[model samples]
Target: MNNYLIKTENISKRYPIRKQNARPDTLVGTVIDFLYKPVRNLKELRNLSSAQNSDYELESYIWALNKINLKIKNNEKIGIIGKNGSGKSTLLKILSRITKPTNGTAIIKGRVASLIEVGTGFHQELSGRENVYLNGSILGMSKSEIDQKYDEIIAFSGVAKFIDTPIKRYSSGMRVRLAFSVAAHLEPEILIIDEVLAVGDASFQKKCLGKMDDVAKSGRTVLFVSHNLESIISLCDRVIWIDDGEIKGDGNPLQIVNQYLETINNISESQIDLTSINRDTNSSFQFSKLIMMNQNNIKSSSFNVGDDLIIKLKYSLKDQNLLKSNLQVKISIHNSTQTEVLNLNNEVSGYIHKLINKEGHVVCKIPHIPLGEGIYSINIEAIINSGAADVINNVGSFEIIPGDYFGTGVPNNTKANFYCISEWE
Candidate 1:
């Protein structure tokens, strides 16, 4: 047996395509006029051996993992982090033997168990009780082995009350609890988990991480893939970051991941010009421009919560008695994966009663800012006050990155998005 628990050398997985021309606009022959001129970002594709019709220059093969090389040792707990389509899941699948490599070799040295999707490989048709035995057998456990661990699994899953129920009837969270408990209790030599805790509640997630830690400390190897950087830093000794089908960075979980994050932040900051923000798509009530104003009504984008936020809106009202309008501003603070951490919706004004023909500034003085340090996205909408009625100023999205607040832990979730600055008894 190899001393390293898992090894992969230049491993690549590719999907073969027969070929079809695809673009953003028009049918195969839409008979549309060329003057319409749809806007699109061009994609550069190149070199696929079996691709027919050199007519549309072949693009690069969409290989998910390009020449990945890694060696995992026994009892090592590793985390994988990256953006969407970063091949984090693909790498796990290859190691789980669920998918085969197209270009290189991946070798595993021990009995392996993988939890990718909660309830994956589970038979919906089977009763929860029957599925338990089935999963154990698939894991190469004998009946006696499963029986010995059955109670523990049942207790951990907290589904013992409904053990006889059909698994299909279980809620998404329940399925996750049951599936995680079964896999965790089974005692596999190598545990490959990919964002499984995301389905469970927060407490369950902490518990599951504790379980994984126990397993790793007891000499079982673990490979984890998650978007939660905190978990990656706390639970993993190292990290492997995949990006655009290649290893962008691989090393200490914190340092390398921080570098990747700075790159992401910089890329996002480049797109915040907001110059054409108020342009109308269909030309209803035109929003000329809006600016975040201060206590003195000075326009600005950056501000501390509780500090005055002025909204100077230059708009042309197209209709009269546009009465009962709501000028609502929504702020959503999200993580890199787009999971909403904290959301604040301030209904700054209602019942615009009448429209002043000319443009004017709508002042929104925030008496208390309930947020810590983080980045947030703001959306401004002028609603006609009914369920899904005509939207006036539909312009949404302006960045509201939080400044450092002394003595507060950095806010990064929906709860941490803002702080109340309170004392807990």
Candidate 2:
């Protein structure tokens, strides 16, 4: 008997690319296109042979996942990390039976509950109370079983007052809370969650993480995907990194996340242009540039312990009117081990900016660098009116050299992430 609870063999998925000018809406055109697809494919295959290149035939489709072979043991906590559109969600969809692979096979030997998206598996017209039973039944749970755990789910969700309310009227956070509560409490052998947890607040996200930890400790399998590297490093025992529809690295969580972060490092110059970086395009504002400097206000990437480190972030607004809204900026510092060492936020620091132009900059100053000797990376995020406008990871990195933080001139040699002043009693 195999101990693997999930196994995928050479799985590949492809979606046909539709031409922008192709008119397939008409029934006749649709029929003709359908009938001609086989001939077109055959011609493409012949062209592939003549051209001696497989890429010639792959122009008509995009491969979301390619030749992925994975075996997940029972009760393993696996974290999947990748850039946007890198096929992390596609792999989870395949494992959840929500989608089929174009080629290869996947075998799952346990019941699965997936919260891939907010409000997924929820009925808009049905009450939250109804959806709990509905999702439970979908997960192969009996009514009696749901009944036994119903109160627990409701209480965990913290939406008891709205349990009888329709799902359509529930906020995104509320829906995620109830959906996660149901999926986590129904006792499925395997649980798969995507980035949907980002919809909740900080407290709720912490609660959900705790619940996931408990579930994993109970000998259940968990496959999680998130952009929060800190959460990934803390919760997952193993991690798999996907890039360009293929597995890039798989193994220890910290190592894999660190490798991924290194690949995304975009700091090639003292001042980097952030306009062309990959990020969410729906936001009304975006970061334009990032500049790092030393205490002398000169561009530098090397700093000593207890030295003042300065950062300047430039941003632009799509609409000038948005300047009236409150803008918040955050900077996260992480060591080479992918562990977050410090987070600096304007809101937390009680700094308010009064902007008068569509383009402006924010400056953050660290009075004394507390980090030990090592290479560290910076991640930046901008929020407008409580909505995340831009988030760029590994925007830059700086080196921290040895310095006497305690002013003892003793040359404190330690591998710790940060150092603090100490005195003999």
Candidate 3:
């Protein structure tokens, strides 16, 4: 008998790209187009056969997963990390049987429960209580089995106050809470969760992580996909890094997570051109550039522990009327481990900006930087009238070398992200 609970062999999935002019604008064309789909498919097959195997030339289709092979042993907790649009969710959906791979085989030896998206496998028209039983039955649980676990599910979800209300009335957070409660409590042999847990509050996310830990301890398997690296490191023993629909790295959680973080920091530069990075095109006010400098105002990406650091943010406004609104600029500094060490913002500093131009600069100066020796990334966020206008993560990064913050001439602790200056009594 196979000891692996889940196994996939050369699994791949691709979706046909819809052309802009492929569909007709009129009814008669729609009918003819529908009738001729088979012919079009045959032509596409011929084109695919004659075309190069390179993804760039394959305009007709885009591969979401590319020949992924994995073996998940029983009770193993695995975390999948990747950028957005990567194949993490596709692989989970395949293992959950929610979708089929285009060309490959996946063997699941036991019952599997998945929470891929918010309120997935839930009926909006049905009451929360009813959906619980419904989802349990879908997982092959009998009425008696559902009855045995219903209260515990409701209690853990913290949605008992509206258990009898229709799911449409519940907030996204509530639905995720209930969905996770049902999926985790139904006693499925394997639990597959996507980033949907991000919809829940921090406390609830904590509770869910603890429960997943308990589930894994009970000899059940878990396949989790999340962008939260800290949670992945704490909860999972192994991690898999996927990029461009292929496995790039897989091994120890910290090692794989560090590999993933490296890619994010790889984009960092002394002067980051934020306008070129992927961002919301509709944003009214956006950051255009970020320049890091030392106290002398010379551009730099390296700093000593006690050195003064200056960050200059250049932004552009789409509308001049936005000048009337209160603009706030914030920057978050995080360590190599992705733990945030400091947050600097204009609003908190009681500095109100007087915007007189469509484009301008905002400068944040920090004196006596207490950060220990390590690499740090900076994330920028712009808010207008208390509403987020533009938010960009990992906009740039800097390095901090060893320095004496306590005036003792001793090097700061490298393990910690920040150092404190305290006088000995």
Model 3 Cα lDDT, one tens digit per residue, 298-367: 8889888888889999988876656656678889987765557899889889998855588999999998
What lDDT does candidate 3 reach at residue 312?
95
Index of the highest-TM-score prediction? 1
| Candidates 1 and 3 compared by lDDT, better number | 3
In order of appearance, the predictions have TM-scores of 0.61, 0.57, 0.58
The segments of candidate 2 whose C-alpha lies over 4 angstroms from its true place after superposition are 20-59, 268-425
In angstroms, how far off is 92's CA in candidate 3? 0.8
> Which of 1 and 2 is the better model by TM-score?
1
Mind giving the per-residue lDDT tens digits that candidate 2 earns over 1-425? 89999999998877543321122546887799889979867765564343323234443455778899999999899999986667999999999988777778989998888878755568998999999998878766799999999999999998999989998999888888898888778578898988766778889888878888898889989999988888889989999999868999999999999889877653345688898886533446788999988889999888889888899999887765465567789999877655578999987999987545889999999978999888778889877655456778778888888887777678778877777766678
Best by lDDT: 2
Clashes by residue pair, model 3: none
C-alpha lDDT of residue 175 in model 2: 86
CA lDDT for candidate 3: 0.80
Q: Order of all candidates by TM-score, from best down to worst?
A: 1, 3, 2
Candidate 1 Cα errors over 4 Å, as ranges: 15-60, 267-334, 337-373, 376-399, 402-425
Q: Write down the lDDT that model 2 would get.
A: 0.80
- Residue 353, candidate 2: Cα error in Å is 34
Q: Rank order by lDDT, top first?
A: 2, 3, 1
